[model samples]
Target: MKKKSNKQVLEMLRNMAEGLGQTFAPFCEVVVHDLSNPKNAIYAIENSLSGREVGQSVTELGLARIQDPEFPAVIANYANTFPDGRKVKSTSIGVKDDSGEYVAALCLNVDLTLFQSFQAAISQFTKIDEKEVHEHIEAGGNHSDRIHARIDDFAAARATTSRSLKPADRKQLVQELKKAGLLEVRRGAEIAAAHMGVSRATVYSDAK
Candidate 1:
């Protein structure tokens, strides 16, 4: 098979860079570096988030790869920072020809500023503030009112009319009322039985 020329390789990488840039736009930059020309390695750039342009010199990493034949084929998700202090994550891939010499590279730089902001929001949302107030209900007269309120609360939580509750639901209600100490109140069983349209015996059976 005939080996591809430098121009052909550059054309292929240019198409790849353009596609990657369009897919991840605004937050990602795609650069195609012609490693054979270290003095002006950036042959193409798209979605240029870092303000770099064509004809730019190879980066320090690129130079390292040029000096070392054993350089990794793919270096991924390494941390980077832009000039303005925005965090970025990057990946670089070395492209070789039929001769197995690194001739070009494709690099992707992803801005992490938005992701960091989301992290900060999640952290703040989950944090417990010690100064926040805890509510309490005043202990006073009107035990019957409290009992009635408890029954109403239970009915509302079940999303059904108290009087229309089935025998099984009435049993569950009785269990809840007993747990709340409402069943121990005077006339509690009679009031609950009437409210739930069930016999007092049924409430007592459920509480047992």
Candidate 2:
């Protein structure tokens, strides 16, 4: 099979991203990573939810995909978190040339925070006096509470308690948070570092 040129592959991926982003509306962010160019790997982005523009540097996972031949070809429905403490669900699909080398990747990130708030509103509006109600939105807009909840959610995805998370686990958690734009929030790194029981420098390094 003839290998597709990087330009062709990226163009296809860009179209797919734009179409998917439109179909999903505002909650989903679709990004195309050109692994051949790590410093400016975000070849295109649609429905930008993470404040990252095209030409932004590739993520740690992006670098991994470029450098590691054995990197997984697909990752689906992984836990992710935003800087302002919003949770996300994400999927990544590696795009390989006919030569069987990875040339690009398409990632979809779905912000679940808005959906949670919407669920809360509907629950309140349709509630009965005796029915049990579970509130997804925390009261008072407490940043600390939200941060803690995010940590716990990350830990839960790994089937472990936050206190029991290992160093490697914590690093992976940091990476996910970084990709979701959480580390960019004011004091976000500090809060995540404290919750993970690591130094602030360590948290930053984990993202690297």
TM-score of each candidate structure, all chains considered together: 0.60, 0.57
Candidate 2: residue 204 lDDT (0-100): 89
- In model 2, which runs have C-alpha deviations exceeding 4 angstroms? 1-4, 125-208
For model 1, the superposed segments whose C-alpha errors exceed 4 Å read 1-4, 130-208
lDDT of each: 0.85, 0.85
lDDT of 1 at 143: 59
Report the number of the highest-TM-score candidate.
1
List all candidate RMSDs to the true structure. 11.2, 20.7
Write down the TM-score for model 1: 0.60
Count of backbone clashes for each model?
A: 0, 1
Q: What is the per-residue lDDT of model 1 for residues 1-208, given as tens digits with 9 covering 90 to 100?
A: 2235877998999999999999999889999999989999999999888888899899988998888868998999999987788899999999887777888999999999998899999999999878878643423236556766777777788887778776787777789899988888777887777767778998899899
